[model samples]
Target chain A: MLPGFPHAEPLAGLAGGILIGLAAAVMLLGSGRIAGVSGIFARATGVASSSMPRLAAWAFVLGLPLGALLVMALNGPLEPRFLSLPWIAVAGLVVGVGTRLGSGCTSGHGVCGVSRLSPRSLVATLTFMATGIATVAAINALT
Target chain B: MRQRLTSEALVALVAGVLFGAGLALGGMTDPARVRGFLDLFGNWDPTLAFVMGGAVLVMAMAWLIQPRMIRPLFTDVFNLPKARDITPRLVIGAGLFGVGWGLAGLCPGPGIAALVIEPLSAAVFVATMLVGMVLVRLFEKDA
Candidate 1:
């Protein structure tokens, strides 16, 4: 694991943010589609179709793992904190609902929406972020 | 459809950087933190919500400004998805996402974002997520 920071490293976070912005911009500019993860995932699964969009979507999705592999190869090894299978399955279900409800996942609204400056995206993004925040708060309160 | 390769590459690079930075700063790069937030009915970490809120604030500003400034970047016009009241699809998708997130503590963007810091689990989460996406597509096609 990377060295843990005391409060959250602004530099590290900034770097991460830059990467997301760059990725979204590139996907749009090059492929002419928003780098929305749900859409990408849907297309990859064949639930949705758009030849060029699908290719780019696949590339983006595949690149994610490839990038992780590169990091793992270099970093030695990393282990995720384990959670029960049922819990993981449930979490997946919630996120799926949220994505559909919000009309886009974080990648689409949070990244692409902000970049393109869409009002509807703004509201949806706000709702998403808010809901996420509330969920965390409630989770924390109960736990 | 064709543009200068260099410019396209630059866009991709920038988007990636921004995306990565956001994940890192939001504390989303850490599954432990995500778990903490989801452990709400249990441990109750509430920080993720705040981070999401901050992101929404930035997005809100962008939404207000985008249409006024840029008519359209690549497409003839920016296409907005139809605004539909929350439906069963929304509920189902969000619920699935939450369950996965609570268990795995990683959403697609943040999960992929974690690659910069952690690799193994991130890889697993991303792979499974893709599988889920593909499954959705296959089922949809059959329907």
Candidate 2:
């Protein structure tokens, strides 16, 4: 295990993942939608419209914080340390545009699409993984 | 008709809650944990991988059940991505997203979820992200 870094929480990870899947499943089976946050955000913000309606999109967006609150209630609040504001802004811009251009993010492509064995999602997932790995490696090396 | 919308909205709210909770519980809401997952060359944490795996496994089952059904429970039709052929937009977009994800260790889901945890920074990232999405929409329209 890596020193200083927390040990991998396989159980919590798996449980949380199952919950994610359940969320996706509930959306798919109940609403016939992909629970992709970027897409949902776009829809919620009136930037884009998908098969789902705007009202429903807003509901989902609002639930995100509520759900996080639930976790905090059970496990306590998390204290996250983010990068500098400028760097974060840059990253956010790229991600927003990229996800739109690409058509999906981790939730849509990585989880929902891949689970369905979608070729496009597969390619997108592979591409992102490769680049994510490379980008992290570069960042680590440069810093 | 109004009742239908309300039900769908409720479903979406519940799904969003689950998705957000899952993200938090799985540690995806933590930027450091996400970055650690991407840090393959260094002290890499495999927690996110398990999270992804568990989510995929369950969602796969959902896909299996989807094909058997004529329509989704709430919607009249299932809205799924139709792109099959790989294209430049997909690859380039995915690449850009990966870079941004690595740079900030944040994505759409976690970014929103983190709003409650780190209000100011997360808000900055989310605001810029919305701007990016709007930029893409405007560009696509002109093109």
Candidate 3:
């Protein structure tokens, strides 16, 4: 679909996204929880509290990387890079703080909440998308 | 209770693994791919939009099923977010998250999923992100 970006895999993206949605659906139906990564991480780390059991939270967190490793073992290695060290650290810190304070991330707000037409999530998604676009624009201009 | 807890945790593991696989397959695990999507003004990659659209479409269906069911399959009650107010804190936090996402092209989910894909980089980001979470708890007693 993207002519400008030849490497842009639309089909893969769509399929993958569907799988993600299914994952969230499973979490909602089976455990009655939003698959908000930040929240799960927080609960596992004891930074947050909820009806979720700690063991469940830990299981989910551990499962994340194991799944990735599974993918690599099957499809070969993936080459994913970071923004060097300094910038990545800064980005990580800001994202962590922002997600906790805002009470959701891409999964919680962008996928689950937005689909349900929640007003707060709608606003949050719009705000983050706009800011994310603007920030990328600014970075491109500066660099 | 122990048996129930085990079931809950196993369900969570399945969801988490599916989520991680989806992220990697959809190309969200790649910072470059995510940045390309964010780089709207530059070589814009529309793959992320397709991913978002597909996920949202599926999630909307899941939401339709949510209200009819009193409780989830394994859990007694649903534990979704309830607050709906559009607050300054939410906007600010989301905006900051956008900045971080644009800068590193790594949000909470992708950041964690990339642990096995890009070990060193993902670890740094996750560690700093954890510290950021801790800082929030330390500074904001209300949080």
Best by lDDT: 2
lDDT of 2 by residue, B55-140 (tens): 99999999999989899887787887777989999999999999899899999998998889888888988999999999999998
DockQ, prediction 2: 0.83
**iRMSD (Å) of candidate 2?**
1.0
Residue lDDT tens for model 3, A2-111: 67678789998998899889988999989899988989999999988888999999888877887787778877888886679899999999999999888888999999
Record all residue pairs in model 3 with backbone atoms less than 3 Å apart, i.e. clashing: none
The C-alpha stretches of model 3 lying farther than 4 A from their native spots are none
Retained true contacts (fraction), each candidate: 0.24, 0.82, 0.81
Model 1 reproduces what portion of true contacts? 0.24
Judging by TM-score, tell me the better candidate of 1 and 3: 3
User: DockQ of all candidates, in order?
Assistant: 0.24, 0.83, 0.83
**Using Cα atoms with residue i matched to residue i, what is each candidate's TM-score against the true structure?**
0.64, 0.97, 0.97
In terms of lDDT, model 3 sits at 0.89
Off by over 4 Å in 2: A1-6
Tell how far residue B128 is off in model 2, in angstroms: 0.7
Model 2 RMSD in Å is 1.7
Off by over 4 Å in 1: A1-35, A41-47, A50-103, A109-143, B4-13, B74-76
Error of 1 at A128 (Å): 8.6
